[model samples]
Structure formats: structure tokens, C-alpha cells
Target: MSGYLFAILAAAACVAAFAGVYRARAIGAVATTGPLKAHSRPIYHGLNAAIWTAVPAFVVLLLWLAFQNSIIDQFVIGAVPGSETMESSARSLMTSEIRQVAAGNIFRQPTPEVQAAADHLRSLQAVSTYLLVAVTLAIAAIGAFLGMKVVSARYRARHSVETAVTIFMMFSSLVAIIITLGIIGSLVFEAMHFFAKVPVTEFIFGLRWEPQIAIRADQVAGQGAFGVLPVLYGTFLISGIAMLVAVPTGILSAIYLAEYAHPRFRAVVKPLLEILAGVPTVVYGFFAVLTVAPAIRAIGTAIGIPSSPNSALATGLVMGVMIIPFISSLSDDAFSAVPRAMRDGSLALGATKGETIRKVLLPAALPGIIGGVLLALSRAVGETMIVVMAAGLIAKITANPFDAVTTVTVQIVTLLIGDSEFDNPKTLAAFALGLVLFIVTLILNLIALRTVRKYREKY
Candidate 1:
């Protein structure tokens, strides 16, 4: 039934879009006679009409789809005797579970009330689909008819269409900005709640590292400790090690691509770098655990240094490999953004290519390069899978990269991965951690933007 409704909606949308296009083109052809005719071509006019016809109807269809399931479930729950005794949301869940069972997705038999509710829901769905299809088709047909009628000699279709398209583009850009602000707003609210429970000073400045809390009100071993020192230490350790591996390797690769490597080498290298980015982090995590950790351990033992099976070194090194493409790609763009004249001027003044690059190009691209590094660092800080799988989950405050350590992201994942009560502070703590991570990344991005702007002004 859902599939049938979707098919009808799709057909209606296509019809509306094609109708709008036809109307706009006919208007363009007729309206060319009068003085001050619109500048845009007939096809543009047609495209504008087609977009308008599709947009509103498709929006309506989406809204209908979103509400349909809830409305049907509510109706079914309301019909069932004693359903009102259950909480409204719980009743909805029960109804949905029964529906699943009735549809043969589950083996368990539902009670009489649940079975009745499921039957009612199926009936409601059938009725809703019929109504939705009727409404959508009616709207599409009306819109198409109106559009065809509006195509006349006096109508200025082209100008109107272009203006609408420009407005649409601006609106599209605003949606992205609005969504970013929304996420930040949500983060702020949760962080504020966390700060209320755990003092900001302790979270920010405490020296200890523990996140254990009593699950039951009576059982008490470790509770009320919210120190973040270990998590911060782990973050810095892993990030620092990653940078140590990534920076030199990435910079050399960028230099080769920009200054030394032939076009042939570059053609192969760029795609391979992109392929590195495409590889899933989970796959990299496996590689780190199976390959890198054992190798690091062997080397450590041979050199008379004790190394844990789950050391920061392994995770950090693998993370660095993951970040290499990010650094190299961004660095390549930064280098490319440096004007050719600057390098040519230095070389013409008797400087070697290396000297010119070192003195002129590097300085010019420094700000952008820093921005890229900060971006990569932000990613490292938030990275969960690599650290979770390779770096041990034990939160320990340590400076040694060869020791087991954990990060904020790892804790957040551990805290929220399984079933937990909604009201539990442990679960809520994940939101607080998320909020902190969001703010840190946001600040880093703003700093990078400012740095780049300053650099541009200088150059």
C-alpha cells in the first residue's frame, strides 16, 4: 500500500513538472510580441514553471507521508478497549508492534486487543492512502491546468521565472546556515544542563580521570566524579601522535605534487589519495588492531621497551594514515591558490625552485595550511571508531604514546551504545560530551576562518 501511494505521488509530481514547463514555454512564445519583453529564453521560462509546479506538490506529499503513519496508529489505538489506560506513546508503540506481528514479521502472537488494533490500523492505512492519492492528483491537475491558462501574450514569464529561481537559490543557501545554527543551539542547551549537575570548574580543571556512576540508588562504589583530565590527555596524546606521523608525510607529498612530481605521477597520486578517504574507518580500525598494533609491540619488545597491546601509538599511527589524504588534498589546494607570479618572481631573482617555494609559496599558503591542519586535528579529536577499537577503553591520564589511553569520543560511544534509561545522567552525559565536542570543532573552524582571512589580507 505504501508502495502504491508512492508510485501515485511520483506520477503526479512528474505530470505537474511537465505541465508547468509546457505552460511557461507557450507563454514565452506568445508574450514576445509586446515591448519590454523578458530577456530570458523560452526554455528558462518553462523550467521555472516546471520547478514551481513540482515543489509545492512534492512538499505536500512529504508532509502527508510523515503524518500518515502516526494518524493511523492513533486512530487504531483509540479504537482499542483499555488502550487509553496506557500512556499515549506506549500505546502507539504497542500498536506498531502488533501491526508488525499481524503482518507476519514477528512470530509471537499478539493479545486480542492488540490484534484488533492491528486490524483497525490496516483499515485506516487503506483509507488514508486512497484519500492521499485523490488529494495529490487533484492538486497536481489543478496546478497544471492553472499554469496552462496563465500562458498568454501579455504575461512576462521569463523575468518572473528568473526572479523566482534566484530567490530559490538564496533560500537553499539559508537552509544550510539555519541547520548549523539549530545544531549549535541544541548543543548549548544540553551542555548547560550538564554544567548544572557537574561544576564547570571541576570538569575543566580537575586532575583525576573517572566517569563511573552508581546505577542503583542503594549500591554505591564510585559516584559523582566528572573529571575530564584523562579524556583530554588521551585526546591530545592521540592527536599529537597522529600529527607527528601525518604532517611530515603529508607536506612532503604536497610538495612533490605541487613542485616536483610530473603530471603523470600526479594523475595517479590524486586518485589514490581520494581512495584512501573512501576507505571506511571500520576497515582502518581492523588494520590498526591486526597489523599496526602487533608490529609496534614487536618493535617495542626488541628495543627493550614495554608496550601494551592496546597502545595509543597504534591508534594514533593508523589515524594519521587516515588523515594523510585530508592534509595532502587541502595543502595541494592551498599551494595551488598561491599565485604563480610569486614563485616566478622569486625564481627570476636567482632563487632555486626549492628556495622560492620555501621562502615565498610556503609563507603565502601558511594560513591555509594551518587551517587544514586544524581541520584534521578536529577530526582526530572527534574520531571514535579508530580509538575505540585500537586504543583501549580505559581512561588513563598519561603522556606516553605507548600506553593504553581513551578519549572523550570513546567514552561518549561507550556511554550511549546500549539500552539505558532516558533519565539516567550517564546517558545524558553523552549529550554533554557531544555538546563539548561541537563547541570545540566550531571554535576551531572559526579560528581557521579568521586565520585564513588575515593571511589573505597580508598577501
Candidate 2:
């Protein structure tokens, strides 16, 4: 049987078993009133039984699925004539071919050895399916029987169920934490390898970034520079421009919507504003390239100013437009969260509407506002599609918005594209760029968290 079919059968069996056990226990508790008065509800007894039946069977199923392929491959390899003499890579390739033949996905006719191995694989898979079904059902039945045996008045089924659920939740949380740690660990480890080849100082402080190393000895441009400052500068330059556009406009729009707009107008305007957030970044990239870039170039030419066809200004402007809804929606919530009483008090004390908003509501909502802006800044910094499509790939350390520039994310994408050898510095440098970006983003988040906490405590 397929895993999903088995899972469905197991779940149904557990449910039916739990229902029967719960009904019997409840009837028993009711019949013997004094000493056997139920300590927990019938639902708790049922849940406890269900958990016992499902958890163990699921764990066994998972372990089997995890190791089944490798175990079967080993058996297939041993059965194939002369397979033991093959190198590991050759064995792996043969194993893959056997699987392809078994699945009938082979592009060419298989040799007799491979055909024999494929037949054996199919037989093993058939046997394994029967065994999986038998073992899973047997374990579920045994677990259900044991769980039902313990169902009594003083069993504390509720406590047992709650503890199990709590443990499961903690495990789920730890899984997330471990996954995040794994990502960081991988990035750091690869980045360390990169740093060993290219000095940390040169990568961080050097001005040029030419990571194209020649694969052939006779190829020109063999020496590749690993400087990161140019990309970093471009990232900050674009992000800064985006924030400058987003912050004031979003905050003011939020303030107007929260404090002044009519209810109907607010309802309509809010969704329209938030719709910008839902639009894909790729769409924004197209807008930047087809519309914004040309307009800026035309205007710059008319005004006697030089503008690159692929300029930071065009990308940053479009990116800022994309981030507006993030800042506005979040800041709107923050502003709306400020108590009406505070606003009334400010007004009663002879403050103008604008003054009351500026001094009372905005100040009260500053923490959330700052948090929202920081989040928007992160969004702007991490944007890839817009930068890739609109901002040119030339990494230059210029403050002028009209100059072509690139970001760390864009460079990372460029470096890792196609079939890349991980050992090469060109590819490893992507991880190095990723590590720095991760660190920078982490630091920003830490600062935002600290600021939010301090102000939350004060408020």
C-alpha cells in the first residue's frame, strides 16, 4: 500500500478504536458511582487512546520510509552480479538506473543485470508494502489495547493528554529553531571556507568585486577580486532611497486614514493600499524597467543630468512603491491602537487636531511605527527581482542614484546560477555574501526588537 493510503487506514482505525474504548469506559464509570466516579471526561479518555494509537505507529512509519530506499538499494546491489566490484559512484549510477527501469521511466533498453535488479527491486517493494501495512496495523492494535486497558475513573487521562500535547508543541517549536540554526551553520561553514581562500579583510574592505575566475589555465581574467563594499554600498543606497520615499508617505497616509478619513473612505482606501503588497515583486520590476526607468531617463536628459538606462533610482523608486503598503498597514494599526481617551485629552487641553496627532498619538505609537519601518527597510534590502530586472549588475560605490549598481542578493544569485562547482571561490563567495547579508539583517532585527521592547516597557 502507498504511504498515504496506509496513513488514512491507520487514522480511521485509531478513531474507531478510541470511540469504542471511550464509550465502554464512560458506561463503566456511570454504573459504579461512588468509588469509580470519573476523574476525567470521556473525550479526554478518547484523545489519550487516539494519541497512543497514532504516535507510535506514525513514528515507525516515518523510520521505515526514511531507511527503506537505502536498504532496498543495498539488497539490489548485492543481488546484481559483479556489482560489488564497482566504485561507489558507479554503484550509485547503477542503482539509479535500476530504479528507473523498475518505474518504467528508462530512456533506453536495460542490460540483463539491470533488468534482473529491477525485477528484484519490484519484488522487494511489494513485500515491503505488505510488511508496512501488517506492522503498522499490529502496532496500532497493540497500542490501542494497552491504552484501553488503562481507562479507569482515577486514570488522569486529561493530564496525560495535555502533557503529550505540550510535549508535541515543544518538539515542533524546537524543530523550527533547529532548522534555522542549520541554515545559519551551513552559511557560516561555507563562508569560512571562502574566507580561507580569500582574506576576510579584502572581502569586506576591498572596493572591487570581480568573482569571475577562469576555469582553463590559458583563459584571461584568471584573477578574481572578492571585495564586498561596492555591493554593500549599492544595497544601502537603494534601500535608503526606498525608505526615504516609504516612511513619510506611508506614515502620513496611515495617520490620515486612522484619525481623519470617513469610515467608508477608510475601508475602500485601506484595501486598495494593501493590494500593492499582494502584487508580485516581478511585476514591480517590469514597472521599473518599462515605465519608471524610461521616464527617469527622459526627465534626466531634459534636465541636463546623466541617467543610466538601468539605474538605482528607478529600482529604488519602484521598490519604495512596493513597500508602501507594508509600512502604511502596520503604522495604521499602531496609530489605531492608541486609546481614544488620549486623543480626547490632547484635544481638550487646547491642542489642534494635527498637534494632538503629532504630539500624542504618533508619540504613543512610535514603537510600533519604528518596528514597521524597520520591517519595510528589511523588505527593501532583501528585494531581488526588482533589483535584478531594473538595477544594473555593475557593482559601483557611487552615491549618485542615477549610476548603475548591484546588491548582495543579486550578486549571490549571479554567482550560484547554472551548474556550479562548490569548491570554486566564485561559487563559495555566494555563501560568503549570504552570510554577511544574514548577519546585517540579524543585527537590524535585533536593534528593532530592542527598541520595541524598551518603548513597550515605557508605554
Candidate 3:
């Protein structure tokens, strides 16, 4: 029933958008009379109207939908007898049961104390949903009507709509900025708490990393080392291997695809490469563990090297393969963005194709290539699944690529896996690791940005 109502609302919105567009066009067509001309094409006025109708109502609907549940819960709780005496946790559970019951599904009845509260919640939800639907429809109608009214003689609808759109776009850009700030703030706050409990020097410089600190006195080995050296070493080692494999393979593939491959070949091959990116990391994890790790171990044994079954090489190699599409796609864009004039001039100078490409094309596209590599590197660093599957859980401080090693991401996952306390050093340490990873990626991105900017200026 709710779905039917939502579908009706959506269909109405679409019709309103189309009607607004058609009305704007009709008004523009009528207004092209003697001596009073509009600034834009009729279609532009129509599109302006449609956008005004859709965007604002779409935004309002989203905001309302997001907050409606909390509002309904508050109202329902207030209406129930003695509900003011209920604990927040009890209230939360009662609300969950209320939602299930409202959906016409049987839920385990709430405790006797909250039974009346649950019943109240169901009624509130129905009322809230009806009210939300009406309000949303009303807003959409208002926006569409206002847009239609403005589509007349002497009305600069195109300019007005464009100004509104620019403001909306600015707000959209701030969403990403706000999210990033929120993440950084959370990481910093948790990391500060972790550092307060465990000394900063010990966490940073100590050579060991055993984060098992028991809160109870009876537990054996209460205090554990918080050394990040092992994790950092493993992180660097795996990332180094990933870069080693990814850079050459990715750049070469990109060069071939962008510069050498025929259009038909590109059409077939590009989609295949993108498909590689689409494969989930967990699926890659299984492949890395089952296929790559074993293959590496077998090959190593045949040769002189004693490769650990959970070698960093296996994780890195698979991660590199996983990130190949990221690098290739970005590099292709970068190469494509290089100006034709530069390539033509080099070719005109009697330079061979290879010589022109090396001297002119690659240099012109170097910044983009570097940016792609950095972005791919960031992906590699943050990747958890491939490492978790192929790399050992034991954080070993080692330089050997053939040995078992663990990364910061893997450690973070382990620290907070299950049955964890936020205050426990083990769980808290994950935030610290997360913070370090964040900072490292931030630095790489900044460098990439600067490099790209420098190259753009030169070009």
C-alpha cells in the first residue's frame, strides 16, 4: 500500500515536470511578439521550468523521508501512557517492533510495560506516512505551479532558474566536503582518546604490536605492546609490491588502450577492464587466497625462494590486478585529454611515432599518469579483502616480500572484528591505524593535485 502511494507520488512528479516544461515552451512561443524577446531558446525556458519543479521537491522529499521516522517515534512515545518513564533502550526496541507490526508482519510483542507504547507507535506511523505523502505532493505542486507562472512575457525564467541551479550545485559540492570533515573529525577524536590511554611514543616507535590488554587483573598478560612498526612495515611492503605490479601493467595497458589499440578493440577491451573493477573485493579475496597465494607458494618452492603460503607478494599481486582498471581508466582519460597540437607538432618534426610519443605525448600526459598512479595507490592502501585473505593476520616487521605480513587495514579489521569494547586498547587502536592511513592518503592526493596543476600550467 505504501509502495503504491509512493509510486503514485513519483508518477505525479514526473507528469508535473513534463507539464511545467511544455507550459514554459508554450509561454516562450507566445511571448516572441513584436519588440519584446526572451533571452533564451524556448526549450531552455522549458528545461528551466522542469528543473525547478523536480530539484527542490526531490530535495524536500529526501529530507522529510530521512527525518520522518524519528519524528513519528517521538510523537508515538509521547501519546502512550506512562511512556515518559520508559528507558531509551526500551523505547528503541518498542519502535522496532512497532515498525514490523505496521508493515503487517507479526513481531515478538514488546514487554508488558511497552505494549501500549507499541500500539500507539503503529497509529502514529500510519498518520505520519499519510502526512508526509500529502506534504511532498503539495510541495511538488507548488514548485511546478510557481515555475509555470514565471514562464510568461518579460519573465527571465532561464536566467532565474540558472541562478537557482548554481546555488543548488554549490550546496551539492558542500555535501562531499562536509562528509570528509566529519570522517577526519571522528578519526582525530578517537585517535586522541587512544593516544591518551597508550603513550604516543610507544604506539608510534615500539617494535612490537600485541594489542591484547586485559581489563581484569586475573587475566594473564594484561598489558600488551602497542607498537605500530610491524603494521606500518607490512602496509608499506604490500603497498610497494602493489605499486610495483600496478604501475607498469596499468600504465602500459593504458598506453596501449589510449594510443595503440584500434577503436573496435577498445570497445571490447574497455568494458572487460571495467568489469574487472566491478568484481567485488571479497570475490577477489577468495581468488587471492585460493589461487594466487597457492600459485606463488608453488612457484617459489620450485625456485630457491621459500615463500610463505600467506606471502605479501600474493596479496600485492592480486591487489595490483584489482586496481588495474582504476589506473587504466584514469590514465586513458589523462592521455586523451592531452592536446592534439602537441602530438601533431612532434610528428611534423620528422620524429618517429615512438619518439613523438615518448618525447611529446607522455610528457604532456605525465601529470595525469601520476594522478592515476596516486589514486590507484590510495585504493591499494585502503583495500582490505585481498590482504585479509592472502596476507597473514600476524603483523610481522619485515622487509621481505616473500614473507607473511599484515597491513594497517587488515589489523584494523582484526581489532574490531567482533565482541569489542570501544574503550579497549585493541578496538581503540583501529582508529589510530585508520587515522594514519587517512593522513597517508591525504598526502598522496595533495601531491597528485599539485603535480597535475603544475603540468596544466606548463601545458
The numbered model that scores best in lDDT is 2
The window of 10 residues in a row where model 3 has the poorest summed lDDT is: 109-118
TM-score of 2: 0.90
Measured over all alpha carbons after superposition, the RMSD of each candidate to the real structure, in angstroms, is 3.5, 2.7, 3.6
Give TM per candidate.
0.84, 0.90, 0.84
Residues 1-459, model 1: lDDT tens digits: 546756765665566556656665565565676564545554554555555555566667789999987777777777888776888678768876877965768667678777777777777778887887777667756665665565555555677676877888998999999998898887677777777777888877777656666868776665656677777788879988998988888877888898898999999988898688788999999999999999988888888888889889999999999988888888888898988888888888999988988888887888768867886887789899989889988877766667789988999888877777646556667777777677667787898788777665246
Instruction: In angstroms, give how far residue 286 of model 3 lies from its true place.
Output: 4.3
Candidate-wise lDDT, in order: 0.77, 0.88, 0.81
Where model 3 places Cα greater than 4 Å from the true spot, the runs are 1-6, 21-35, 38-60, 75-113, 213-215, 256-275, 278-287, 298-306, 350-354, 452-457
Model 2 per-residue lDDT tens digits across residues 1-459? 556746774675568556846675666667476655667777777888888777788788888888999999999999998987999999999999999999999899899999999999999999998898888878888877777777777788889889999999999999999999999999999999999899999999999999978878988787688899999999999998899899999999999999899999999999999999999999999999999999988888888888899999999899999999989999999998898888889899999999998788877898879878988998998899999999989998986788789999999999999999899899999999999999999899898878777665234
Q: Which stretches of candidate 2 lie over 4 Å from their true place?
A: 6-10, 17-25, 28-36, 78-87, 107-112, 345-352, 454-457
Put down candidate 3 lDDT per residue, 1-459, tens digits, no spaces: 445655655675567557666776676677676577666665555666666566666777678778977887788667767767989998777677766665657656555545665577777767877786787667767777776677765677668767877998898899989998999999999999999899999998989988898778887787888999899899988888889888888888888988889999999998898798899999989998999999999988888787898999999998888888888888888889888888888888899878987887777788778878887888888888888888988887776677899889889988988988798777899999999888878787888888777665357
Which residue pairs in model 2 clash with each other? none
Best-fitting candidate, scored by TM-score: 2
